[model samples]
Target: MIVAKQKPIEEIIEEVKDSKKLLILGCNECVTVCEAGGKKEVAVLASALRMYFMNKGQEITIDEHTLERQCDHEYLEEIRGNIDQYDAVLSLACGVGVQFMAEKYFNIPILPGVDTCFMGATEERGVWSERCQGCGKCVLAKTGGICPVSRCAKRLFNGPCGGSTKGHCEINKDVVCGWQLIIDRLKELGKLDDYETLAPIKDWSTERAGGPRKVVREDLQA
Candidate 1:
């Protein structure tokens, strides 16, 4: 899942300082699971903004709403009629959701309420860790399901980079060496020999040389 953290209240207020009428939009997907941009967060932000404006003797009208997903055209269309009523929209979804709303509602200014952190998984109730960098080329087959691209601070293809000490990353004592984890996992599965093969140099041209990349599936095309 993509994890995110809420932007500070001061920063959020500054974005809509000129707007009297605002809409606080939330998502019911990934952000909800991370407790960053869910319905509850929307209400909290709306109330905080209202309080801030009130304390400053400025009257502001803030409305809140949560969509099943802001990235989908169908879900975004549901707000077509009412979105125009507000001067600006504060999207409490991930960066993708903010961009999608901006693209669909070209006339209104859309502001992000959260900082998209990383493509990661929940480690505990409040801990989220990075797991993938979306490098396009996947080499997990040889690493026993551990992703070195994101877990390793250096993103080494075949590594424990001599900097690792006592199974911990040199960059941070708290961080476990990504390669160590990979070795342990492979050893557990009786595939320790897999480490003998080094990965080929990544072809970045195929992964990201051009502008934005797009995947077209003729089978799914209408």
Candidate 2:
């Protein structure tokens, strides 16, 4: 899942301070699951913005709306009729959603309300940890289902690095060495011998390093 966090209220307030009317748009996708930009968060932010303006003896029209998703055209079209009523939109979705919204509504200013973090997993209700880097390649098969590319502090293709000690990353005692985890997992699967084989030089062009990437399934296209 893509994880993100809410931007500071002060920054958000500053983004729309000059607008007479605004829309606090929320998304019910990954941001919602992470508690950054969901329906409840939209209400909280909208109410806070109102309260801030009210204290200044200024009145502003702030409307709250949560979309099923802000990244898809079909879902975004739902707001086409009413979007123009607001001077600007304060999107509480991830950066992707905010950018997509801007693309869909060229004349309106679409402001981001959250900082997109990373593709990760929910370790607990409020804790999220990075799990994938979307490198456009898979090495899990040889690495015992662990990704040294993302989980390693050094993004090591083949290593526990000399910095690792006692199976913990040298950068931080709390972090388990990515290679150590791979070794342990491989051992459990009786595939420890696989470690003798070195990983090939990764083709980084397949990753974001090559620039924005896209995949198309010809059959899926309508």
Candidate 3:
């Protein structure tokens, strides 16, 4: 899942305070799961902004809307007619959603209401930790399903660094050595022999090195 966090109210206030009318757009996807941008969050933020303006002896129109998703063209199209009524839209989705919204409505200002963090999983009720970097190539098969790209501090492809001590990462004692976890898993699976195999140099071009990435399934395309 993609993790995100709500921006400070003060920062959000600055983004749309000048507008006579604003729309607080929320998403019901990953941001909702993370409690950053959801139906409830949208209501809370909109109410806070309304209160802020009300205290100044001013009035502004702030509409609240929650979409099933802001990234998909089909979902975004739902607001095509209504979006123009607002001066600007504060999108409480991930960065991709905000950018996609802007691309769709080029003339309107689509502002981000949350800071997109990373692709991660919910560790507990309110804690989220990184899990995947979407490097284009997946190596979980050989690594015992643990992702070194996201878990390792250095994103090592071979093995743990010399600084690692007692299964702890060199960067921080609190962080477990990613390689250590991989090795242990491999051991449990009785596949320790795979560790002796030399890992080829990682092709970084498949990552951000080549710029924006895309996946198109020819068979899936209508």
| Global lDDT scores for all candidate models | 0.92, 0.94, 0.94
Clashing pairs in 3: none
For residues 57-176, write the lDDT of model 3, one tens digit per residue. Answer: 777999999999999999999999888888899999999999999999999999999999999999999999999998989999989889989889999988888978999998889999
The runs of at least 3 residues in candidate 2 whose Cα sits more than 4 Å from the true structure, single-residue gaps closed, are: none
Candidate scoring better on lDDT of 1 and 3? 3
Report the CA-based lDDT of candidate 1 relative to the real structure: 0.92
Q: Summarize candidate 2's per-residue lDDT along 153-194 as a digit string, tens digits.
A: 998887678998999999999988999999999999999988
Q: Which lDDT value does model 1 have at 102? A: 96
Off by over 4 Å in 1: 206-209
Among all windows of ten consecutive residues in candidate 3, which has the lowest summed lDDT? Answer: 193-202
Q: Which residue pairs clash in candidate 2?
A: none
**Which lDDT value does model 1 have at 179?**
96
Candidate 3 residue-pair clash tally: 0
